[model samples]
Target: MRKSSIYSVLFGTVIFTTITAALVSVSSNVAIAQILPISDRNKSENSISQVNVLFVNPSIGNDTKANGSESAPLKTITQALRVAKANTEIRLAKGTYSAEMGEEFPLIIKQGVSIQGDPGSQGKDIIIQGGGEYLSRYYGSKNIAIVGTGNAKLAGLTITNPTPRGYGLWIESDRPVVENNTFTGSTQDGVAVMGNAAPQIRNNNFYGNGANGITISGTSQAQIEQNTFQNTGFGINIAQNASPQIIANKISGNRTGIVVQASSSPVLRNNSIFSNKEDGLVVIAKAIPDLGNSSSPGGNQFSSNGRYDINAASATQQVSAYGNNLASNRIAGKVDLTATAAPVKPLSLLTRRTPTLLNSRLQRETVTPQPTVPNTDSQELNYVQIQPGTIEFTAPGAASQSSSLPALQPASTGNSALLPVPPDQIPASKTGSPYMLPPGLSQNPATIQPTPQTPPQITATTTQTGSRYRVIVEAVTPKQQELVKFIVSDAFQTNRAGKQVMQAGIFSDRNKAKNLVRQFKNNGLKAEVIME
Candidate 1:
């Protein structure tokens, strides 16, 4: 590694029995602040590799005549970026600096320049504020606060409150390191990755942003790890052929946790997704998110969402041969495979922990069978196995008893067992499958005899069934009408006179309706299904 101006010293001491003579030795600590040349701005006429340090202190800096040294620093980061050369280090002090103060918006850093904040403080003191409520270069709203082209690094700074259309950081560059930063209140997104920019975004906190916390688009690839996305619209939005490694993130309290759309294939591993208003993960239109791979363990926990934990919208888009490994994910709602076939059981519920970076050569982890699907009453399933041409249920004793029951009519060619037969529809004679019945269904087979006629089959391909009614979960007054817009964003709604009412969902399938009510109730909403 290349060594910079920063220095450190390590010491070791040992005590022996010779110290028994009431020996009380003293310990001393020492620190030295080294000063270096501000920059080699004039060195274009010559070569001065030794002068690589540039300092910026908003309070003490002089934009007109400062030499960019520890004693004579530049006034603004924009000044340093303009004068500094490649491999130059710009050291920032504690203060709030804005682009409106003679500095430019969308401050572009030169190639190979690393912008670093105070070493003693972890960015708590450095603040970079920018203008614009919405970001659009054409409209002059200044869409991005910081823009980097190549070999740029930013650390230990809080970038907040750019124009609503602006983002904290916008990278069109390649190989940037953005760490130890907090991004908040951006109207569009916290970070927008465009082009082939592959940045390392780690240990960052993104909160209360107007749009998706981070958006990766246009063939951009990034490693997003150990970040916190709270109270945002979407945690991470991957689109337009962008593929990112999203790992170890705590994504909570957002409208939707992660949305994979438009042919983006992102690797989502070891993320904790919970408390979103909508689904934890929504895969739409050919977007394939790799939850698990042979080389790495994929166990993301998803729970407490308003709808299904994972909604694989189209079956034709296959993420993997066995689908993404959801083995250890703590899912509250069932997986809604409306158009897709469910993944196989064996690969879905493997129990191995993810391998550490140092132990890449360890043998493939053992696959642990998922806990059998519990009784379908109040207990939600831990796993749903969707296999090609068959749907397998891991109910404790349901497998042996399935042979005696009437075979469920499989759906279309690729979708078998996609739709489960309701317990109430089963004939009075033959006992129903354990996986089909909710809590109070008949379990004793001796009481009823099998009907001579074949029972009606429920195919998965059918979109609607049973009743076409929705429960009005809540009624809002005229004064609280604004809240209806927020609730309607997640739930269906209708207006009557001056009042607004929220509908859990309009469902022809009773089971789906019940699941919706349960999902709404889980989010502390009073919801029930009404049969019409």
Candidate 2:
């Protein structure tokens, strides 16, 4: 509850509105910016708690006869929304609430009425798919899942709207708290803040949407922080007079990260923009983004994007980029690099208990090392590059995001234990990815050289299916490619680090895959099976 000149909320944390003071932040740097320091970074409880609680379970509860209680909960979220009043809390159970499940589209959440799902899982198990037409005053009829009309909150829900020109959540007017949610597979943006709305959007996972992760327009000023936007078209799209504060979000793996156009001005600070196929931050038209200045350091990090990290599309527009970390030499447009931003160390390099000061949360700038293999002289090479150990960012309030390398523990047999990478690290095969690596990093396993056809021989799949698994056999030598012909589906997958690998088949029975594992083991090859 510490007070300061600047009001602030940490990434992925449960945010309750204080809305005391907010104004232009881009004109200055993060160092001089007055951001409220939260004495408790992980504190979820705050003043202005919900007045009433209503429960809805799509599995067992009855929609028509139920009283929206815990035991006798409503069946569908639409039913709960019909009876929920202002200041009421609607709790959803773990299940799909879609058209097939009887959920009505474009569920309108009234002011002060909060809708919450499982924040811990980022609502992965709590799916709310399908969208309905929402008539917006700014735009015409639009298809969206939920519309937050002023001071309502949508948290801990996995929302998707697959219709053409659809969005997961749309906010119009007033302020809303949209946190700890997963917005994916939408035909349009995961969330759109329009019509002078200033919503607090933090700790959400936005991916695989047709358009940008979050599109801000019509003078909307949103506090977008601590969100990880990957594999989307554009991470954050700002257009036409909208001015939002974009802070501390990791925007990567998209065609482009942040695009500001049509006279919109956004304050960008402490964000990690890296390894995108194109520019990280594209500023077009008359839009002016406060990247950084001499007086206040931006503290933003950029690296390894295929094109320029920050592309000021207009040659006439000299982006006032001062005191910000610039890792790449590729530059487009006129940018004022008057001052050098301090080099931020990776999170793995620091050791601390909890961050009380706002500056301590400064993100790591991406650094890409040369992609080369280990020579024969080197006895062992830990293929994983320098990745920060366990750093947590919130979409589920406490999820750590970093590329994990294979551990080279001293084994008696001198074989490295190949572990499966995090599911999110791997880019989905649905899109065209040049190489969605973590700052251009890939390491070779111990004693195992990579083949030309399949970069690394030691392969592991992250997906898990019940009662069956995919056996990963190491093809250390090129001649070993034909050792197993059990490749079932052309489920060709690229590893999280953008390394292409030959994946084994997913047998219907675990026993069949076990036989393959045993067969590979008998052939003096190290093999392991993981889920799916």
Q: Which candidate's TM-score is highest?
A: 2
The alpha-carbon deviation from the true structure for residue 95 of candidate 1, after best TM-score superposition, in angstroms, is 0.7
TM-score of each model, in listed order: 0.54, 0.56
Model 1 alpha-carbon miss at residue 139, Å: 13
Give model 2's TM-score versus the native structure: 0.56
- Per-residue lDDT of model 1, residues 158-263, tens digit only: 7764352446777755888888887765544678775677888988877655456887765667878889887655678775556677878988876568876655
Error of 2 at 516 (Å): 56
Query: Which lDDT tens digits does candidate 2 get at residues 264-288?
Result: 6676778999977557887755666
Q: Candidate 1 overall Cα lDDT vs. reference?
A: 0.52
- Show pairs that collide, candidate 2: 6-34, 29-296, 383-443, 463-531, 464-531
- CA lDDT, every model vs. true structure: 0.52, 0.57
TM-score of 1: 0.54
Which window of ten consecutive residues has the lowest lDDT sum in model 2? 389-398
